[model samples]
Target: MRQKTQRRWRILRRIDAESRALAETLGIHPVSACVLLNRNLTEPAALQHFLNPSLESLHDPYLMKDMDKAVARLRQAIDGQERVMIHGDYDVDGVAATAMMVRMLSALGVDVTHHIPHRVDEGYGVSAEGIRQAAANGVKLVVTVDCGISAYEEALLARELGLDLIITDHHQPPPAFESQIAYFGAAVAVLNPNRPDCGYPFKGLCGCGVAYKLATALVENLGHPGNALQRAYLDLTALATIADIVPLRDENRAIAQFGLERLSDTKKPGLKALMGVCGIAGKRLSSYHVGFVLGPRLNAAGRLDTAETALNLLLTRDDSEAGRLADALNQLNRERQEEESSTLQDAELMIESGADALGGDILLDSDKALVLASEDWHMGVVGIVASRLAERYVRPTILITMGEDEGKGSGRSIRAFDLKKGLDGCADYLVGYGGHAQAAGLTVTRGQLSQFRARFLQVADEQLGADDLIPVVDIDCELGPRDLTFELVNELRRFEPYGHENPGPVFAIRGAKLLDQCTVGANGKHLKLRVGFWEASYDALWWRKGDNFGRFSRHQLLDLCFSLDINEYQGIPSMQFVVKDVQPS
Candidate 1:
């Protein structure tokens, strides 16, 4: 069966005068300038910076709130030769962040160790048991990377155990009380951009980005070559930044831009081995490689096994050990994929069943939200399943793994809905919850699952409008077939390292005729087409869209939304179009 397209297409409107002015001043095509303008790069300096992000454009690390304090404490620990513990989360961001901090400290001649919480056992953040263990191990200082922003109780516990705590995280802090002066109660320093009081210019850094800032400041304060050390750790920072799905703008853009360059020739044996195993070594890397290939491999260790496996891979200097760990992680990733596919299938089957089977939950009635639960679902893969479900259904989706008494839930939301806020509205049913606007995690008691599901659905229904349900195809600008030149495509390369806020441009072509088309790929799941207007024609690849092959005939007029790409075959690079959506004219 063919799936129908349910997206609303809107071409971005641009002021002709502004486009003309920008094009003339920047000495570029009007369409390119219009795309920049659409991204809010209007000011001359801003446009220049956006096009050519420089390493110097990165803000000073000291500007972050508590930077000086965190640095001073860390320097003292280093000077005193005290034992320090790096506490990190279990995901890719946390693993990279932990590795970055550990390496920086080790280079500074400090006695440092690291701890990554077990995904199913310890849960997220700095756990009380972990801090107690650190204290038992004679650790005088504990710096948490990628987590601990919401560890109010754990912070207090650290204080009680006489362990100094420094929290470096990017996740939203727990709500502060009106009378409370700071969010992380007993921690010596908390470095997070999301804190309301912090005045750091850019607030979009991921957890690893925050950890990198701390590392940068610590390296510089100790009279070391800060930039040199920063360069060494850029691969790790970039890996986490991309994997964590942070916005690639401002300092982040510079970090990813330079990091990708550095990652191409990474000297770290673990990363080199990982790249080799993933079959991306020696290739020019991009956010795509980090986000898809390497990130998942690193994350798989934490998901199915211990995060320490990934951390050890990052810290190991032995080539043989690195290869073994890389092989193990690759195996774990394969296992993770299998679990994800099985869980996704089970979730879809549950959805296909009727509401009566789900105890008449409101989620079944409104279809505005989905709250799927199963005792058999693996917790690590539920988030991926939730993301897929949200994208497919065009609504917020929560997948929960039911335990004996409580259930752990992960949620993904459509653009119009704020998942964190939705969870907040249903807080009465949740034991605890946290996350950002688009994604979140929660814990709900098995007894209250029905109530939470109904309440979450109500929140989605009340908040989401009918228009918000339809997916949107936001065209950057309209381009004629004549504009599909190699020069213009090369100029577009200036907008590199696209992610989150800074997206690759999408252009629409009107009244194009399909010259030839065919179903391709395994299972004929891709549509390969030659489309053109007048005398100009280009090859187009529509992925997973072969079901629509029957809708088109040769010489049929169609409107196309697509992104320009460069496809290389036998060392010859040629222009190709990635078809996003096609409709009859």
Candidate 2:
């Protein structure tokens, strides 16, 4: 056993008094109050905002940059009875957005057909062939959701074909079109918060969030709040908001909190069946449910076969058919998980062989601009893997699945790096690229892969630093052993639905004793232990921490960082620490 070091408690100098005051005012423990203050919820208004997330508090949908123009164009199409095409990306955000728009238009009695581009054939966004197909099918107006903000070439083609395009996307803009592409207003109206001059109050919206705004603006303008379709689509917006992993803050929090409520009693046959199969029917759902269980199944369709399966499942109205589709999606999710593990192993090996030794600023490349091939690398899971790789490496990472002549790659980045801006720096080597600061996608020619790789590395070298690459854990307060109490734990519940931006609070606990410890789980992969603090002993489990058990010893005093969680096991509810890290005393 390793010896533990004595620990000292610390507090932020500026907020010490304020934290104490907040605890008194809110009737919560001092440590819980400190956690709230640490999250910048110091002001009364901030506390109110966090505690009461209501729809009336939501930001105006029209506050978005392209709202007026996008709404105007959609209204015109509806008024004229023009044939409209809802062209969407294949992921959950895209599918939900497409389904929302389609249902709304169908209710408006407009001729609308939804089209989700196949992952294998069409890749992402509006392709030339996709645009041509829409035109040939008499799609007079094309509204793109969750994608196409960066489709300069494709938008130009739509203009030439006399098709009106309204792009409601959340991806970052390409360099050439970074400054208001105007494909929408000039000929179409493009709605995206990330536009350099968009002037939208919040720029953190996901693609589906933007689509929801578009739908909201359209429905409101048409004076149809009571419309069945308008009401039904809110659940889609909720699913997308949760699936896209956007911060549950500001308007997004309002949407998701209420949206989950809508999902619990959803009237849509497809959603009802999907929820039933996932064993969440009639239960209050949270973002955790969407991210872990539902999102993967919806995404599995695109990863293993065609995203059309997901789109169909979302759009269908038959219980039996929805059940069949849901089962298939569940199976596909299992297949995706298996393939993801295999690819991740190879990626882990490649990174371990010194590629990621820098501990930051990772650059992954091969004969292709990004090597996406692993015999069974399901396309859907690659994005998730790429995101994981980026987070692990603490740098922008591009994971590619090789194509015949070129390759398709997805890029995820850390806060210090703006992935889209970096990709723009290497535009000469890219066939096409676009996405937000943290995540993006691109196509690169085989011949230019070397140049792209070099440029990417150079950009990182110029832009990043040693400190910028390391992970940061921001603590709200330091609590002594005596501070562990059930009341304190229950008081923290005021801040429910914690997620990105408004993360669950982390607290420091000092002078704790490890009463018992053991490596548990299948193959002894996890750490399980009993920790004694205050006058009580509590059970604690740390997933994937078996390898790190060297940091603690039996009956050793130590400092621990963790979040409090209420775990209900076998009808017993108890407070447990979701252990983050441990240090010697």
lDDT of each: 0.87, 0.76
Provide the lowest-lDDT 10-residue window in model 2.
366-375
**Pairs in steric clash, model 1:** none
Write model 1 residue lDDT over 121-228, tens digit each, in one string: 888778878999999999999999999887878888888889899999998876652234443457889899888889999999999999999988887887788679
**TM-scores of all candidate predictions against the true structure:** 0.96, 0.88
**Which whole-number lDDT from 0 to 100 does residue 389 have in model 2?**
69
lDDT per residue, candidate 2, 182-225, as tens digits? 55444467788887778887787888888878887888899877
**What does the lDDT read for residue 564 in candidate 1?**
94
Misplaced by over 4 Å in model 1 are 1-5, 177-185, 355-365
